[model samples]
Target: MTGHGSGDLRERPRVLVIAEAANPEWVSVPLVGWSLATALRDVADVHIVTQVRNREAFLRAGEVEGESFTAIDSEALARPMWKLGEALRMGQGKGWTMMQAVAALSYPHFERLVWKTFGADLEAGRFDVVHRVTPLSPTAPSPLAAKCAGVGVPFVMGPLNGGVPWPKGFDAERRREKEWLSYLRGAYKALPGRRATLRHASAIITGSRHTASEVPDAFAEKCVYIPENGIDPARFSLVADPQGDVLRACFVGRMVPYKGPDMLLEAALPLLKAGRMRIEMIGDGPMLPGLKAFAEAEGVAGQIGFHGWLAHERVQEVMAGCHLLSFPSVREFGGGVVLEAMALGVVPMIVDYAGPGELVDARLGIKVAIGTRAEIVEGFGAALRRAAESPQALCRMSAAGRDEIAARFTWARKAEQVREVYDWVLGRSEKPAPFG
Candidate 1:
């Protein structure tokens, strides 16, 4: 289960990246997969194998499909089931959870296709490592780990992250978000290939303490904690405009129940009415109508600007124009937007629970203690008031946040950290330097 170091080893390893969602034209996990895969090219000779849906986008991005990347067609295998899931989701009205279930069902086929196409090269030692970068959930099992083990090729899983529970409170928000599937999330461990994937993985990289805790005691030795979310320095540049007397706060995600945008709106109402602050809502969701209505009801609608869905770059621009990012989503997995805000010198005010709670520290920004929904709203309002009254303290935190991200959270830095894990797996080191 351990490897011996090569006396005079090559520093750069050849890696096969299995990313089901690595597409440039798309955002979210697809963008994450694409960014992570490309970043690793600086530390390793990388070849990516992803689903066929991403093929055209990769080609458009200047990667020749069969060479720089290989497209594995999964449409035929997934289409029927995906359609059924979609139809059921529409009928039942809880698409996100249903989509996760559908994705879990389809992921094994993508991994199987990856192995079938590249299993020979892996068995023949053409690649130094096999890293599965997508379906980053610890719940979704990959079939190729055991095959890699048998062939003596090391396999890496994750920066894998998921299963951050709905915190002790917030039952109302959870129920409103239609998280029926959250109740069944734990059953994934009992799935057919779950144990073997964990058992045979040469290294298991977890993103959060919650997911890291889920790794069984037997495979715990190989588990390393490295957050999966990272910032793209090129896209999210540091731009600190001089602060005006009017403090501007922005909430930049979907306006969903779990995301807590309405809670934020309520929290900032006092500031909005007193002309002490401005609130910008920069993304659209099903809750848009309700959010708008609530703002109007509170008589602060004029103080809040609803910029319905923006392009990725535009969203950053909106964020940069603001002073603080108010994101209290209690169930976020990566909270990449938090890092993006920090990259631009905008301090974040986040709830202390899941991903945002894990990333933001006292020095970087404020973490409101989690409590009942009303408590959270009141806490956020108090935090906003503190910022309005203390510009110097806010300035200090903003500078520190920008500095923190440049040093630790950039994509290149994250890639280097992953390379350390690769080296450790190849027997070049005892373990990756602590993922701070």
Candidate 2:
């Protein structure tokens, strides 16, 4: 069935949002799932279906278990699989590929159960759309896509992102992250249900250009480009005060090898010594000790304040007092923190590749070209110098970045973008070209 007479004018589409990892209390994929699904409620009649693990969080967030959302317990398979992944993870927060491999193995069981629970309603045309918001990795194929297609309902999957190949010089970093499965990551495209998932999805929302490129030529027509990360304005309401004489910058994220916290220090050392910049390091990991040692060894410890893993609000509080976010991570899939910094009027100076490249442009913030370790350090150093030399330009970027975040990167704005996909899939209008 088509929509109301005017394509732009239509009833609220009923959507069954499947977010197996959705948790309001969590960060990353779970937060992405929870935020986007709830935001969609403003534009559509949405009923969230999430894994049992997030049930309590959902209830705490005031969602009615049965009416507003449903929790499917796939724990029979999921629990054991999770335990196995933990046991084999090699080290804490390492071996991500192994964990995701374990997840890919267990997730289908969840979907099978989701189909068992929601099949009837979908077949009966009770919902206008079936949207899978989690398992954000493009590596995980959805059998539910084909199932929804068979039931004659539209299926939307993604903003699916991941499989950003480690850049040329980060092999040592790659090994440290325990990304063994990534070597064979492309093989997921050949997995049993992948083609069917892509072929059947009414709209495929890709979160990055790398992910969008992964879509087979045969199914490219249905793809939509929307970044996976967005900021909540309420949480990041404080505007940054960039009035300090020294350029104050903050680096947020796990102090892991790939995140390049050390690289940031190497680049900023000259500025720190000259008292041209003061850096705030937020977050903790194995690299924290080394970073602190480096700061002390350089005698610039006083210039760099290391606040290890502050609460989200506190992180923003620290960030709000700063002028720039210096995040030079070599590999990032979504770069959610960049958006958060922008929302707070903290202009980001990030490596111009992958997620940050897509998110920040010349107008909003600075982009250091992606390169080898030395090149990146030099680039970030130069960018830091430029930021210091021109406080006027920095102030302009502070205002522009915050304004851009409000206009485009908020969860509410992202939901409206998804609504356009809903309208297109329901035959209400021409397909949306979000990039164009």
Candidate 3:
């Protein structure tokens, strides 16, 4: 496809977005996809290819304004035999082995199916650029990147999660990450075509400077730090509640091991014990039962409320009522929830690690020091006490937090940065320009 230009400036280009999952109900990925689509609409013809878990829910969610949506049926590639083998292996307590085997056996076939089903239109050179949002493993590059390359289109690889080596510290965790890396290396060797596909991509976009720095010195030159996530400041703005009672704290998003819901429960125990605060958990996941049990055991059961999973609109409403947002997650590229809380004028008490460390300004919110369970508990307790003792301080931090997000983080700004990367990849720009 030929590039479009208006006068001396390039016209809005057509961009194809590929993601394994983009169901709106799925949380993070969907939000990222939707935001990107919305932001790029003015400058590009955006077409998205993503798997829909629930067709009805997806349809109900409707198309993001100004972008074309294409739904890929995952059922078409759900190999029963592979699933059975994986299930059996998982039953035997070999989860990683099972996952690896299934991915190795099924990914290529799945990729082929996706191509046969959707590649013709894509390969016809209808899109000027291709962007992959969820690059979890080499499988992400296997057929998608290869197809884009085959068509002579510039491919942007990014928002990729796994494969990068974990940071130092946490001996047991590091050992497991090394093992996973070993397996990934073997998998890549076995799938040379997939490896080459990703290596040939025009550029790789990452969510943070931390991720961009860790992009393997081999691809470091190709790596670009363009945050693909942010909060909708307007949606999370502060609200006036004349009858609001008790200090409400909220935990939003998935309840998983790395998310540190357990940490929040532990930290809230002392506050709850003292009847100083009420906790509201607005999401559900595998860790819900454990979190609930811990809260009950700590004698704060009555004070805690679990709203399960709520719609996006409702979540914003719940957030508006919150006095603070407590996120204890240990692993995150950057927590969009933290930004959401900040935008909503809720002080965030986040762990001093990864995402929070990078985004949280001490002047805006508390960054609890990373340490043992007792230390974390103590640190969070101290932050809570500080907020409680000084309402004026909390108000100041809340205003600053909102101001910071408005000034630095926004989907419009993030999308424009991504578009610049696309522009550079397509040879429209000679050098990477600052994404204002």
For TM-score, the strongest prediction is 2
Q: What is the TM-score of candidate 3?
A: 0.78
Higher-TM-score candidate among 1 and 2? 2
How high is each candidate's TM-score? 0.95, 0.97, 0.78
What is the C-alpha local distance difference test score of each model?
0.84, 0.90, 0.65
lDDT of 3: 0.65
> Residue 110 in candidate 1 has what lDDT?
77
Q: How high is the lDDT of residue 93 in model 2?
A: 89
State model 1's lDDT: 0.84
* Model 3 lDDT per residue over 1-436, tens place: 2221222245677877765555555566566665655556556666666655534544676664223565565565555745775565533323343455455555555556557765776777777887776534433335666776787888887655333333344435434322343334445434556547657788887666666664557777777766556766556655523124456788897776555677777766776888777878988877788888888777889988898999877887877777788887665665788888887788888888776767787788889887765677778878777665644457777889878777767766566667778888988885464323
How well is each residue in 67-113 modelled by candidate 1, as lDDT tens digits?
Answer: 78888998987787778777756634355666777778878887888
Please write out the lDDT profile of model 2 over residues 124-243, one tens digit for every residue: 998999999999987777989989989889999999998888898999999988887778878888988888889999999999988999899999999999999999988899999866
Clashing pairs in 2: none
Clashing pairs in 3: none
Off by over 4 Å in 2: 1-9
